[model samples]
Target: MIAVLFRWDIKAGSEQLFKEGWSEIVHLNIEKHGALGSRLFKSKDGEWISYSKWISEDHFYNARKSLDNTEQARIKMAQAIIRAYDPIVMIPVIDHLMATETTHINQLS
Candidate 1:
């Protein structure tokens, strides 16, 4: 499985707007493209994080391409949040159980 972690440091006053925009617009665009599904999270410090899963890199790329030509989509996306970073991290899962085990051990430790 391919996973993407997008971290956003939203503009100071735009947190709620960002979430609402994402829920209303971005989520649909993602689903339309090829997203398996995704979860949105907020840190204690107020940063936004999105974890998106895809079947393959090609699907992810295609979806992104589709989004680019969408002007209204881009406008909504822009209104939702300001990007703090470019090219969010993509992690290819190789051994899920091993990673889970390591996480559990780290939490215990």
Candidate 2:
């Protein structure tokens, strides 16, 4: 799989708008394209981050070449909140990996 990392520093009072737009975009990418899915994160420095996964680089590129009207609209909505936007494409690599048993938040205490 290939991953796309998007970082945005949003303007004040635009959080909800950004989130709504992001959700729409993500849904479209996954359903229409071949995206595995995505996750959103917030940094202490006030950057909003999105990590999206695709089945392959071809899937990602093909989707970018053909965006529908709704997708374009969602992209515009996301652009409206931008102070800065940076996007990066990456491939994952690891030497050692292990799985941990599932644990719930309630079990932490």
Candidate 3:
């Protein structure tokens, strides 16, 4: 599998809009593009980030060539953001994540 990281710096008061758009896009990816799904995060500096997985780098690039049902969501996200960065590709050297009910950040404590 391959990992790709994405980041967006949003305009003030646009958090909900951004999230809604992101959710729409990601669901489409999982349903039609063979994505393994992604985890969303907010950086300490406030950028929105997502780490997504794909079966291969080719899958990621292929997925980007089409945006069949994500037009409105893409518009919302584009309007909400001040900046969007190019996706960062990564190679996996380890797999240490564990599955559990407490896997999320809020459940860590």
Top-lDDT structure, candidate number? 3
**What lDDT does each candidate get?**
0.65, 0.75, 0.87
How big is the positional error of residue 61 in model 2, measured in Å on the Cα after superposition? 1.7
lDDT by residue (tens digit), candidate 1, 1-109: 5777878877777656665666554566565766766667789987788877777778777777774546565565577566755545476756453322333542342
Q: Which ten-residue region of model 2 has the weakest summed lDDT? A: 100-109
The predictions' CA RMSDs to the true structure, in order, are 7.1, 4.8, 2.9
**What ranges in model 2 sit over 4 Å off?**
95-109
Model 1, which residues run further than 4 Å from truth?
29-31, 68-70, 89-109
Backbone clashes, each candidate: 0, 0, 0
Better of 1 and 3 by lDDT: 3
Model 3 ranges off by over 4 Å: 100-109
lDDT, candidate 3, at 37: 79
Question: Candidate 3's residue-wise lDDT over 7-26, tens digit each?
Answer: 98999999888888888988
The residue pairs in collision within model 3 are none
Provide the TM-score for each candidate, comma-separated.
Answer: 0.65, 0.76, 0.88
lDDT of 3 at 42: 91
